[model samples]
Target: MTLTNRQRAVPPSMFADETLMELPPPVRLTGIGLRFYVDDEGRGSATPALIRGQLWPLDTAVTDATIREHLRALVKVGYIETYSINGRKLLALTDWPSVDRGSRSRLPAPPSTEPLARSSRASRETFAVEGGGEEGREDGREEGAGEGGRGPSRDARDETEPSPFCRKHQPHGTDFACGGCASARKRHDQWLRAEAEAEAEGLAE
Candidate 1:
């Protein structure tokens, strides 16, 4: 993935749009983030599992159902258009070229042709909900926590695997940075520091 120096734009009309205003906070935020990471043509692959992983931090336990519901909300708002190509669901942001001129260099185009095999995964997906679990639970075993004398699953604890982008913007089936994540991390750290300083000041008084 090539990193462009151009930052994503947020039009003033976004706040003015009646449809956007009616969306729930989670759905609205997710829609805006999607526009930032989608390809020049505003196309991207999204499954509930993929959305849960890429849209939220690893710790957040948003259910697939929840993600699907928000995606449906985006569709209702006309912010997204979904179609199937080769058994994969693809999303396109409507009128994307109007908002962003996009990269001059061609990236991989969205899948447009039929394939020999249809995906076994249903075109309309169904995901099993993890019942009674709190949101944002870490995927790996906590340090020194044990269960039935067995360690955490090896796959869960592995850290040697490098994610191409920061967890938030990493795309499914791809592992490469587009330089979008650095700004996010910087803002996060700044917020944390500000909170810490405010707490310190409060105690001092």
Candidate 2:
């Protein structure tokens, strides 16, 4: 789906790095990291060490692996840039778009976020129920295999409502754009780095 900045959701503790790892899988950890990026620094940009001391609660336990996993998820999502600091891996959010704000291009590249894989017929069934097929079934009726083989209840279907990852959200390109290799993007420009800097400074179009 097309997303304006307001429509996009970034979690609060995204920069928590390691501490986030302690939270339950997926959402909480990601949420913490999100907040860290957008909140603590006021820049949505941070290094793990730069953030650790600031994010922890007065008594929250700590570990390096937690920070690493948080960073790993961010890197996978394309929200952050990564590098090596001496011997340790480091990460920070993308400070600015590769080009100007609202600057139309082919399509901006989708972040490298890894899609979690779900296996198991039962699990797949659960996912399908929760996330509708490409058609996006709000009415919530399964077309096949109801009681013994009949369709599902309207209520059952409704309860199974799919979230964004529902097949419906991922169309060919309108949801995003192509990155030449089937990856998604807005567009590309040789001078993109310059444009990004100017935009970051609020001095460019």
lDDT of 1: 0.51
Best by lDDT: 1
List runs of model 1 lying over 4 Å from the truth.
1-6, 98-101, 104-205
Per-prediction CA RMSD (Å): 20.9, 18.6
**lDDT by residue for model 2 over 28-137, one digit each (tens)?**
54434454344222233235544444443342454445555656654444345455434454443443323224334222222232221211224336645765675634
Could you tell me the lDDT of residue 85 within candidate 2?
38
* Best model number under TM-score: 1
lDDT of 1 by residue, 96-160 (tens): 55445565423333332222112211210111123113441235423322242122223422332
TM-score of 2: 0.31
What is the C-alpha local distance difference test score of each model? 0.51, 0.37
